[model samples]
Target: MFTSTTIGDLYQIILTNTLICALEDLTTRLNKYKLTACNSDNVENEFTALLENNIRSSCLPIGVENFDGDLAAFFVIENVEKMILKPWGAKNLSLESISLGQYKNEIAAITIKLEDQRRRLTPKLYY
Candidate 1:
């Protein structure tokens, strides 16, 4: 027997993979930092708190435009499954929420990049 693929399936796979990779990268970077210190509990606490704040502040904002774009792309892929299927109208609220999510991811990536750069610049300290 033969099998077929659907656009929705592909989009879901791509989105899931992207999210997994991002999370893995973030975890690896954090673990590397965590292992670098050889200090007292209090010092570790302080440093960890500071890094947490920096990561939170570096995240991006997801706007409606970003969400709508992603949704539109998704719809396009879905439409490929059946040419006669009409595009679903975009929801402003959903778009906004998705945009915010995208912004957060962007911010996370920035945080990771910053941490990586910092580690590279001070290899003796972090490594």
Candidate 2:
């Protein structure tokens, strides 16, 4: 159902309505990254665009089903980690910026917890 509007696009919209409506503070981040405004002519901010695109692609491959606060934090952590590994100048993308109010270590711990939950085994039943 996903179409290519960018000529070279390869998947469903990287940032969908669910992402925009379901997730909070996304617009704020978009504004912060200056992606809220339409580009002029061929001028585009590839770096900031890639920041959101890559993080979404990396975190949720099939795309978001519904909004989960844990998933939201996970996505934020992924972004923060990306910025830390390959920073974009002196710019910062803090969780506080999105009002998550979690420290870096806390985000890591939450991520670990989420991963553990994903790997957790469910009790089997014979039917």
Candidate 3:
């Protein structure tokens, strides 16, 4: 089951197993390396596209949306210790790598948030 969320006039996408996350908020969750070299104007759009494409190409669980962002990021972190940030200053792309620990932290926080969301949304019946 999927529930959609929209924030302001910005964008929203499924970020985890549970939550359709606000891109504005999720952008802050990304580490410096992920944001590096990304045009300041389009970081959220770029990352959202990257995550969606990665999720579609990967063979994750069926119930998990093919466009899930958290799973995609988690998968990438599992495969590599560092993510290359594209070059900031040069017209030529300059890429840099950094620890995936911050990414892991982002995933962990999302997991916690997912747990809370699930708990809050679960039905409670009293007779």
Candidate 4:
């Protein structure tokens, strides 16, 4: 259902789906822990691993276009954070020239809005 042709399109699709998946995982984890939405460190780690594995398997170079707007920003932020904390090598580096900090603020704002919508739309009951 969510397939794409070009790398750019595929990247965007992957990002959107990943974000949705991560958010769902986050909400489930949060509810299980009885928390009201926390930071994204855990989700970010999961997402980074997932993306790294998929990218390696796919054998595709990460492009600036791959990291388009909000989705791209999220990837960049998580990536940089991981790099800082864990100190990994090129495996985590996706885009060549783009600094992860390039769209930092915008991405943060958009992500918050997206998460807010997700929270509102999530069903109170999972039946």
The best candidate by lDDT is 3
Please identify model 3 stretches exceeding 4 Å from their true place: 1-63, 68-81, 84-98
lDDT of candidate model 4 versus the reference? 0.35
Model 2 has a clash total of: 0
Better candidate number, 1 or 3, judged by TM-score: 3
Q: Flag regions of model 1 displaced more than 4 Å.
A: 1-98, 123-127
Instruction: Give the lDDT of residue 113 in candidate 2.
Output: 56
- Each prediction's TM-score versus the true structure: 0.23, 0.22, 0.32, 0.27
The TM-score obtained by model 3 is 0.32
Q: Best candidate, TM-score-wise?
A: 3
Worst 10 residues of 4 by lDDT: 81-90
The models' CA-based lDDT, in order, is 0.31, 0.31, 0.38, 0.35
Give the lowest summed-lDDT range of ten residues in model 1.
78-87
Off by over 4 Å in 4: 1-17, 20-102
For candidate 1, the TM-score is 0.23
